[model samples]
Target: MKVNELFKEELKVINMGLRSFADDVKSQDVPVLHVDWRPVAGGNKKLSSLLSKLKSK
Candidate 1:
């Protein structure tokens, strides 16, 4: 298995947090999976604590 063989498949990217970067990659015709990301609980300590407790169930 040569390194060149690995590149035979089409390039793909998973863009997190920034949509503009993903859009730029798409401009080059490459496929991109965009994930909208934000700070957990919007930077609220209380809300984040509550959410974490809920997930423990």
Candidate 2:
């Protein structure tokens, strides 16, 4: 239950939603897995539908 014990194994992290946070973690030499996140339809339903249709082609 100590920090050292917890890190006895390689530490891995999945960074969600924030690229700057992940970059900071990487700067400290830790491995970071970044997932690209965005708001659904970017808050625009019409644009979302248009993008979806374009991608289906």
Each model's lDDT: 0.90, 0.87
> What TM-score does prediction 1 earn?
0.54
Poorest lDDT segment (10 consecutive residues) of candidate 2: 36-45
The clash numbers for all candidates, in the given order, read: 0, 0
User: Cα RMSD (Å) per model?
Assistant: 4.2, 7.1
Q: List the residue pairs that clash in candidate 1.
A: none
Off-target runs (Cα >4 Å) in candidate 1 are 1-6, 45-57
Q: What would the per-residue lDDT of candidate 1 be over residues 1-57, giving only the tens digit for each residue?
A: 766975998888999977999999999999999987787899899999999999998
lDDT of 2 by residue, 1-57 (tens): 688887797787899987999999999999999998776587798988888899999
List TM-score per model, in order: 0.54, 0.52
Per-residue error (Å), model 1, residue 40: 1.5
